[model samples]
Target chain A: MSGMSDKEDEKKSTKKDEAEIVEENGLVYVDYVGRTKEDGEIFDLTLEDVAKEEGIYNDEESYKPMLVAIGKNWLLPALEEELVGMEVGESKTVEVPPEDAAGPRDPDKIKLVSKRQLQKQGVSPRKGARVEVGRQKGIITNVLGRRVRVDFNSPLAGKTLVFDVTVKGIVSGEIDKINAVIKRRIPGLPEDKYDARIEGGTVFIELPKESRYIENVQYAEIGIARDTLKVIEEAEEVKIVITYERPEELKEEKETQEDEENEE
Target chain B: MSGMSDKEDEKKSTKKDEAEIVEENGLVYVDYVGRTKEDGEIFDLTLEDVAKEEGIYNDEESYKPMLVAIGKNWLLPALEEELVGMEVGESKTVEVPPEDAAGPRDPDKIKLVSKRQLQKQGVSPRKGARVEVGRQKGIITNVLGRRVRVDFNSPLAGKTLVFDVTVKGIVSGEIDKINAVIKRRIPGLPEDKYDARIEGGTVFIELPKESRYIENVQYAEIGIARDTLKVIEEAEEVKIVITYERPEELKEEKETQEDEENEE
Candidate 1:
């Protein structure tokens, strides 16, 4: 009986393997580390702990294995094309030229502004200082007397990029896909905190108490709803449930005050 | 039959009057015109057309008969006191002393700011011109050479006020009370567009398409829920539903594209 069951399990595993392979329009979770080829400095990564170890941890972001919807313009074209046809637990290293990445730098984007003007605007003119002149933001390359040279192009405009990416897994469950969409908006919180589920055609997301009062949280809710409609085609509506409970300290204090009144 | 029905209507009208009259905590819709007794110029009013005709129209505000919860501090303490024990369609003119209205002006609030500094900060300081010095906003009462005298006091300070108020009606229905809570947040949209209902313990509000993308709409939704909980005693949860539909113009275009695809 054990030998018969093992052969049946082998066939089921083979079917699952074929279905889990990456293709266009498939949802896959991946871990990636991207850096410039020129300096080999790590610029971007998916895993949070790795980002912290590399000293690139961003407080404004929550890092995790990203859910990439293939052929959705969610990643660089060169890198996205390389991800196709990869199986679960597969790894690939892709190199992208400047043209395919941030586009080649234009000489016209580099210009000189008055050093005295920068000082008046509270910008201390020094080499490699970041500043915004008028509307363009750039890095100050040189400060020579009254003249300061600035480059308004993308910081990686002229550099080739190297990305080492690993396919973590495929998100096939309906609930997992919904959580993936929720993570894209309320990204500061832990992935497990967002309680996302789908019932019939409506997607419901219960925001954690930590995110109930975040800045522009309503905007984030609207975004999650709109993005879910796009990512989950069968989802007809999204209901974001945000419950604002009275603080425990306040509740306990109120109860204490009432008890004192009762005693009186 | 006509005579008997008329008698029955009279008995029903008496019961309605007993229920509709304003008292402490009663939600009443009122129209009010407030002006300083010292200068008969209107300082505040409720009606939109009247406000526009009087040249007091504010683009940032929505004008309608205000929902006033008597004794809830929704108006001046003196004015709020006058609203209690009022009846629907009842009109009253109440006078308020300067002390009971805007507090008496303090001389310490009047001070001189440097005119040269104002000019340097791009403020052309002239007599009666509004200016903000540091964190205090004030009117320039006098501009003499380099010294500009600014009065950082309430505009209605030291002014005796008179208000001609009329109670339009009382909001007694559950839906109307819910609408009052919603209108407070989405004041820009017309009242007729909002569809609010109470189902079991949940209060559902289907937001108008016009309000789907308003500034801070999520904030507005949250406020509506919190306010409803406070105002509607039976509402255990508030569900604000915002639906974004494809624009009519785009829908037609997509239909045409689909028809062509079917033919192909």
Candidate 2:
């Protein structure tokens, strides 16, 4: 950044005047409120206050802007297309069709199973109750004598999705782009936990301390590296570092020393 | 750090000089290579090179020292007691009795279920094969006609457990103490992803970006804050912040400008 040529430096200053647009492969940060188009029942939100206002204030979940890599399947095709050519701070409401969203509801996904099957699994199936049938999850639509009807179609399927989105920022740079991929593979992590840097076309990421021992984080890390190489073509190697620190011992020693000095 | 008094400064210096000993509630870091006591087959290793040598090199998982807070039940009681009073860099081998490890094997845990039951769940059971039977996991020991014998006991239940333990470092500082609790709740994370700092008894933690979207992470964050207050005592408030960076937008503008200059 400090070694820019005079001509390049001049261009940097004026480039902001030219509108920056979202395009394929561009990473974008967005603040969005998502709802069902039919009823407008809030399904998701990236703002804390809004979540609070909606009576969905979850102390465990901290809400923030979501990062999306354009042209990636991270977002529905309809939503991604609507975001393109948008500028920072620009806001728009996009409606996504069921086909482009969760996909149209399939009647074939519904099945009827014997009540004994649910009972054997210790599930007392009642109408409108959510339960897992075999490997698929579904809602019990009806219960008749010995048979229970389960609908496996996604609840959002066949319904239009409405997203109120604001383009907060667009991402670029080798390090930031890699971070986007990491964020996609591992969502809901805070920003600072990521340590992404590129050296000599290689990317190094230090997984945050809280992620180890997770059931399949090892596989996820490998998946991230593979996906990063595919999307970020310049990344030749992806190295992950896990660091654990012990700072309490020093604090205890200091406390003990302070206690001794006070006695003296 | 900049505003400490002369007395505080003196205490800090002497703390490092005092002979450090492991104590109750003291956090310790250790590098360990665990193997089966009977056969000496490597089960776990914290060094990458060691893992590579043992033909267990996994590119996704980074090996590092493990942090343990004494009396926290993170490690087996037998292993935790062995670590107490041990100095940094001290190494020891601990053998845990079956009662203290995964617990003694229970013959009652073995059962015979009809092969039809497994087929109904789409599971093919064979002798010595691992399979899930009605939420309980077991190893098939025999297939007699239409019956499959399954053992539900833990794999290590009857085995004498062993651990090669080492004391790597001790933890200090208020933030680090809180971080250990967070790490316990969210394992597999690196140390830097934590942004815990205590100011006027209130603890502020900015959840790392990769952690926010994880299922039940919200509960984990809330649990961490509650546990921090219960353990740290002085922490009055726990505030979590989720931040997203758009460094790419600035970088993109600069790159576009650079491209324009090259064209000229």
Show the lowest summed lDDT stretch of 10 residues, model 2 chain A. A1-10
Instruction: Give residue B17's error in model 1 in angstroms.
Output: 2.7
The positional error of residue B199 in candidate 1, measured at the CA in angstroms, is 5.9
Candidate 1 lDDT by residue in tens digits, A2-41: 1123454466664555545776556778889999999999
TM-score of each: 0.64, 0.43
Q: Give the Cα-based TM-score of candidate 2 against the true structure.
A: 0.43
Pairs that collide, model 1: none
Candidate 2 CAPRI-style tier = incorrect
Q: In model 1, how large is the Cα lDDT of residue A249?
A: 47
